[model samples]
Target: MILKYSNFEKSAFLTEKKFFLFYGPNFGKIESCITILKSKLNSLDRTLKFLNLFQDDFLRHSFTEIVNQNDQDDIFGNKTSLIFSLSDLRVSSEIIKLITSQDLNIQNIIFKTGPIQKGLKIRKFFEDSPDCLIVPCYEDSLLEKKEVIMRVFENENIEISLDHKNLLASLLSSERLNLLNELNKLIIYIKTTKKNISNALSILIDNNSHDLNNLVYLLASKKRNDFWNEFLKLQQTFSDEIKFINIFSKHLEKILFVKDKILLGLTPLNAMKSLRPPIFFKEEETFLSQIDLWNFQNLRKAIKELHLCQMSILNNEKSSKSRFLTLITKILDL
Candidate 1:
């Protein structure tokens, strides 16, 4: 019922149980797996029929009625097999008891929705059930790295990598399913476009992403106006909660206040001293030196961009879109 294993382990684990509960924080990968399963259902058995548990008049019908439908008899009886796909698990206790207590002998797959913590709780529930085969779906963290995502971008033949940071950021940006869908769309777009491919693909695959606005503000703060402009050009559909403003405001304050008192002129060392360095930066000093070469004049442009970012936060705070921004503004000077 409750077991942890990689995607490769699924085939071997199939013999272990009949009720497969695929629960995880990462729905993107799980969704892909489901899609694959749906496609392969017929291949597994000619008489196999798939049913959407959340579809039709499911709300009106009790779980017992749902499990014992006439259509189900066609699949559940004799050589026929039933594939039950559930996106939600809010079924009544009566329905759950019916399914668990009876020897239904159906292949049930539950798609765990929501955040990782919630999915984990759902997984534990199924783990206690003796008659079900539960597979908690989670991405392999080691395989999902910046390097792997980049490889996918470079070669369409390669599968997209599930980098934890990028996946988490995408999840925070939107729902897990939506983010996964977007990433898939993005990959398709890149493949179709004739534009010169560069390391810009790297930006699309971040390990950690702040709120879109915070990301916009940070790029603007850095005077990477082109990147900021491109980001803002994205449709309103991408607007995530303004949680990053607090973090953005804090970082902006540092950008404005932190100065290299040790060095009078702009230098590689000075730039490193002034700005908060990201974790990846520590691995490469060349990036720091390039930043330092920009001189005070370019840096001032970056600061001006931050001023605009600050204004955006203030506007959001005033509109009550976010109170965090107001608190951030009060703590830091505009």
Candidate 2:
């Protein structure tokens, strides 16, 4: 029942499953796929109808009652899609089971969520069910972003010089949604405004990013104002709290790697320079500055805090962002 997000057309849409749940941190990819799903629904059968029922409206009727009501809506028994809006509050197995167990007449029952935890009952049901298709949409990694940049850059007919392509890709947002949006704006801005396109685009791309990478350096360097400013932008930019903290932990691990290097008698500057992908040129000074601030004790303590913060999120703690920001403060004091 689990389908790769990229294979939705061949593997998922053509299947006879009645339930489709697209859940993850990749909001843009989820929405883009949904648009394709809806279009396929329309073209696959013109007689088919689409109905949207909100969470409040759904509570008034049982799952069976909802299906039966739609069944009776058209005397000809034309197929219809019943997409129910659900939040974190009502994602119970009992309710999900009510729909999956039935031999329903609905064409599709689509559900969308921000990000479902691994062991959540709702995610478990969808993954286990043959009648359901679950597609997880997470942020693209750097490798994937490189491929995306080429594809999007080519498709958008971007006319930037070859030397700037690598720079543009590196500066791009990791989110597929924001990446495309910013690319479009970049193209338009290029057409109308020629001066400082690269500089303007770099600022736009970095600002658009839900950038844990930048925040880590800021916190480790004890730049309080910049750290919180980026934190505020991150909250508004992306809904996936776990991904945010996960990125934070990863950057800490990077610095920890450098600490290990320093222990081997390599100078801090040389240790940082030895990093494989290399720190951003703009961030090299910041990285060098933080090397002096971090030692084994604080590095271990900060990592321990990150582990606890991740646990808080998995436990469904209220304001996981608070836990994340607290970890930043703890690291600052270290």
Candidate 3:
């Protein structure tokens, strides 16, 4: 019933199971889940068929073609597995109806919905299905953490020791994949240094790891900012450009309204974080704090601006009209 982001695939959904949904923005994650399902069901015959859906040209079927198969027996597992990369729930609903009408006795139907909640209805359908099993693939946490550390370690292998602060800086710049790569690089670095002593290696590793962990807080901030920037972009696309302008207008209005309300005696860092439009004053913080502030009015405005800029880029309309970028630059002084 309840599925974490990582182990959703490994759980039991194969063999006579009713319905299954492999929904998420991570294509890699959904693909991995589908691979596991295929292996479990011994559906090697249809591997090429599944791959065709991903290809541009082969994917010409409507929502009905996915759930309805010519081979009735394969409809259960050999072909019962309905894999959809569509994010539209209404479309998913139509497929579900087709599956019911065809009476495939399907073992599992893998629906890869992007990272959006609009697919909740599709999720609920599986949850409500009597014999169905619902599994959702989300972000993997431990792997992500390991990746962050590995990336920095690869580029800057600390043989002796490293300043905790500078080490943190490198980690901040590194993405999750970069961390794992860096960790392997560190192993190579250690081998080159010929430091066989366990104690020295332990100390070196601990020092770097500690700094990396500390930098996670910084990374968290950047993550929140990045999310905010993205949210603004999405909002602009879905909503009006003026909607963002109004949000920014309202936030500044609120800040001016509540400027004297909050005790300004607090530190700027703390104070800004507490404010309605608190300063995300650093580029590092802006990118790192991508997820911290979401669904906020000010964040909406920021995202809208970003969306506008992206549209401009797509249209090849060059101009200094990126209000979102301008606001971010001004806020962060970058």
Candidate 4:
């Protein structure tokens, strides 16, 4: 039977079916489903021993060997979960032959593949079979991605604001493993530094060098000479100007947030200190200098213009660093 990715659950796998097919372009989620299925199966029957096979090695003889095999492999009567990954229709005839020949004794075989169009007989065969279930693993939705970010942060006791959480959800890799890898780096960085994920986040998202974060943090400083000196060193590292604008704009928003908060009964330092996923300890001096440099109103205006500049750069493909130069001149002059 066909199973939708959205509808898949532990209960769905709790069945008499012995064969399964998980196919999709989203390989990360395909692995995730496989992990879930194995965990559920293991809960019912412990110490599952997995046998890994490829499409090339799979044959009728291989199937026969699996069928004839006893539980001598492990003392726990290990359930065999044959994982045929990166599969295609070439192995379908063998599977069909085995199904037609007799009942499948090995109940944990799974086939994982890339996208299978409707014309593929293998997908159809699994769909039609009572003992087989085919599920499509697809990319995650925006809301789903956001939920992952929230869950990860909540688990770490690292609080993130709604705005940042949304931005991260938007910016992060859609693939489950890649997304988790990025989040893992962020977790480590946050724990070690006891600081914000902004720098690490910017680096990961843009594929930029870690030190470029220093340049971004420096942009908001009142010390123009220091910024210009460091700007030259890091200018070549600005591989993606759009990403730079994104990080820089976000930095400004951080200051703008503090500036806005200052309108209340809080001091600039207090407002900066209050930021969750706290500002980097080393960057605190520059962050405070930013608060003293620009008023809330101008900083807000500058941030908006920076975003507009980003759009202009995106639209005007011919534009160079000159545009950033012009924008920075205007901002520093402010």
Report the number of the highest-TM-score candidate: 2
lDDT of 1 by residue, 1-334 (tens): 6555455344544544455555554565566556655555545666655655554456688666665663234534533333444555565355456655655645554443433344444455566777665555543332343333455455666344445435534333333455545556666665677432233244553423533543534342344554445446552334343334434444444443333432556654554455654424442353343333334454454445445555665454333333433433332222
Per-model TM-score, in order, reads 0.51, 0.65, 0.43, 0.57
lDDT of 4 by residue, 1-334 (tens): 8888767774555456677888865677898778877777777777777777776665544655654463244565566767777556665676677765664567577778887878577778888988788887865656778888999999998888898887787666566666777778789988998778776666655654455576677677745787789877654333346666787888888888888788887988899998888998987887888777878778778888888778876665335446777888788778
The C-alpha local distance difference test score for the whole of candidate 1 amounts to 0.47
Overall lDDT per candidate, in order of appearance: 0.47, 0.72, 0.47, 0.73
Root-mean-square deviation (CA) per prediction = 11.7, 7.7, 13.8, 13.2
Total backbone clashes of model 4? 0
Question: What's model 3's TM-score?
Answer: 0.43
Between candidates 1 and 2, the TM-score winner = 2
lDDT of 2 at 69: 78
- In candidate 3, what are the lDDT values of residues 1-334, reduced to their tens digit? 3355456546654655745566654444566666777676665354323422432322575555544543245435334445656635556567667656655654455566665454376567676776666665543334344444545454555433334433332332122233344455556655777664354346655654444333333322334465455545433222123333444444434343333333446542454465544543553354323333332454445445555655664453434235544654543321
Model 1, stretches more than 4 Å misplaced? 5-10, 36-44, 70-88, 103-112, 115-122, 138-142, 145-193, 199-334
Q: What is the TM-score of candidate 2?
A: 0.65
Clash-forming residue pairs, model 1 = 19-133, 165-207
lDDT by residue for model 2 (1-334), tens: 7898768766634446678888887777787767778877777787878887766775687656776777544877678787765666364654586675656556677887778878888888889987788898876655666677678668866655655766666556657888787677777776677645577666665654536567666877888888888777765445445655666677777788988998999988899889988888888887888777878788778778788888887776656656776776767777
Clashes of each: 2, 0, 34, 0
Which candidate model has the greater lDDT, 1 or 4? 4
Ranking by lDDT: 4, 2, 3, 1
